[model samples]
Target chain A: MKHYREPSIEAAETGKPSRKGLVFLAGLTLLFSSCRLDMHDQPKYESYEASEFFADGQASRIPPEGTIPQGGLRQGELLYTGKMDGGDSELFPFPITQDTLVRGQDRYNIYCSPCHDKVGTGRGIIVRRGMKQPPSFHIARLREAPPGYFFDVMTNGFGAMFSYSSRVQPRDRWAIAAYIRALQLSQNASYGDVSEEDLEKLEEAATE
Target chain B: MAQLFHPNINILIRILVGVVVVLAAGLGLAYYQGYYSVYFSQVNVFREQPVMFSHKHHVNGLGIDCRYCHTSVEVSSSAGIPPTHTCMGCHSQVWTEAPILEPVRESYRTGTPLQWVRVHDLPDFVYFNHSIHVKKGVGCTTCHGQVDQMPLMMQVNTLFMGWCLECHRNPEDYVRPREEVFSVSWVPPSNQKELGRRLVEEYQIKSRTNCSSCHR
Candidate 1:
């Protein structure tokens, strides 16, 4: 206490603070500022950064064997695997209504249209840009291919095509497959496929 | 000391010292005020990247959707960065021999990923889910600003916790129709508050103010 008060008392009496004391205080402040070792630089693991703690040296740990996360118990065959017990299912897992078709169309336009093209002609912008052109949906082979086949392709991926499992959900995959079927029908359908009223409308449209 | 300073000189010296102190205080106040400003925060600062990719060229000129490159934004936590194949898809045909595209070509040739520098990086602790925000009908322009207009992608928002809470406090002001989620030029329609209220209920959007919502 005496040492602390001595300097200020001396300064007041002398009308000037000692330069030595000022220099010492400034040096102490500089040292304290420079010696910042805080929680910011504390030992912590960042995502995907190397870790010495883990034996494998990876910060990310693999999930335990047979561990299924919440809502991840994908039990049903058609729902999860896009196939029946034996092979690709002939029927859709759920009913495909007009709304479902619309959803499918929207999702397809967003995800599939990049490579499959709007009309499924296999000449999408990416294909034109130099990526390998996928087989057109209008092709007889693909037209005859079951809906499950398309689902499997989207789920498992085929050739250069990457699996869209993460991007497109299971139901949306079916929708996309339905849209592909619709595209196939649009290209391959004959005049007989049109209803009489629609035929007349088409004829009138052609005439006009 | 043989009269080192005259009385007037000493007075002038004291006045100058006072002025310096006042000026320093004024400067400190200005710095504090500008701490979160565009200049200090680097809000519109164009960050340089390995490749001089132009968002304006791809988004505005070519009319490419945001999802074209940032795929899985609707489903994944991250807006997925385009793989080398995606770049090669166009550059292979258009900029086949341009030296500017040499890095892209090299990536394609070697199958090594391009190291794109991230611009709008949040703190490590902040848990952000792109899908949840997109699904909740928040438009891309809400947080990202007019990215389509920028030639170089610059972080427009301050992205501070307070900035995030401003929206989370009342999401209706920012929420849009599902179709308008990706529309960069979308503005609130006339009945925005009403529509937003309806949507908040319909979508079950309870903007969680709990710190753990983002912190964990």
Candidate 2:
């Protein structure tokens, strides 16, 4: 056949590849470029993204009034509000079990330890870092303050401290109050505060 | 024609061309590789903050917990920065006259915030929840690296999509006990892979690879 010949000298000088290489490269490029990016800029409304469907033109719909949210029902005054007859109450809504105390400790370390400190000394790491040092729980005034008073401060903002109702639930707030009471008791404890059996253990440890 | 006949000269030309090609290829590969390497990708780039607060000093030296300064870590998406009062609580007593603390004092006096530059910044599109991660048994060190060791905060991980996917697809490899979430020096136990799997089941963590999980 007339055209069945080796590549010409001109082809070598031009540096043209054989037909197979060009076709292969074209196929590879097409394969890569064909991937659909439809998922990236999706037709979706983000949280609070404005919408035309709602009359307010806001995507986030406000819950209807009198709507008791799931797990949002606050039936008891002492449990939720920390108040009875518009004043702080002394009694706990739930029994203060050892498990409750442990939960209180965990919650306290996470939330209150920054400001009130591990010992409720008002000299937490944040206080050392530079925030206003609150009154120590060991102070006679705070030591005598009822548990509900602390709960009031947490539920409703007290002075410079903001309300922790958002971060802490009502039950957890009571737990924190209980823990704070324990802390106050710890720092202000006298020999009379210890039981006879615990006193013996303490004496033994001291003698050792 | 005479120049072409010189065999040594021809050999020298070939060797020079070969060296150029090898050098070019080496440089190109290095440019590609180094661009993505953890060492070079802003890994140790320390941004200057308004206050020269050192995590090394506050965390390691003073034994401060990560939550002390980043207060809202357990409740909010962003770990809240400590307010100006938090700084003055100590400076009001200790470093009252130190010139290094001038800006902090000024912010306190003005009732204005010291605008601390964020170091570990994520893109606007990505939705990362600190509370979910922290509550799900991911420790502070798991994502933030050894921040107590960092004198000035710097981005350590690349925080690229692949890096995120690597963990998201296999959370059992990294999950720890909830109690150890705050422990900066916490090491995975000898039976970690086994424990982690149990934790994955207990925590009910479905390591989702769907785009909407993080993107939305």
The most accurate candidate by lDDT is 1
The DockQ scores of all candidates, in the order shown, are: 0.21, 0.11
Tell me how many residue pairs clash in candidate 2: 8
Task: List native contact recovery per candidate, as a fraction of 1.
Answer: 0.17, 0.06
Write down the DockQ of candidate 2. Answer: 0.11
Q: For each model, chain A TM-score?
A: 0.66, 0.70
Q: Which numbered prediction scores highest in TM-score against the true structure? A: 1
- Candidate 1 local lDDT, A31-102, one digit each (tens): 465345453234666434456897766555779999998988888888777788678887889998988889
The CA lDDT at A19 in model 2 is 73
The clash tally of candidate 1 reads 0
Return the TM-score for each candidate structure. 0.69, 0.64
lDDT of 2 by residue, B109-178 (tens): 9865666676676655788889999988999898888999988888878787888888799998899989
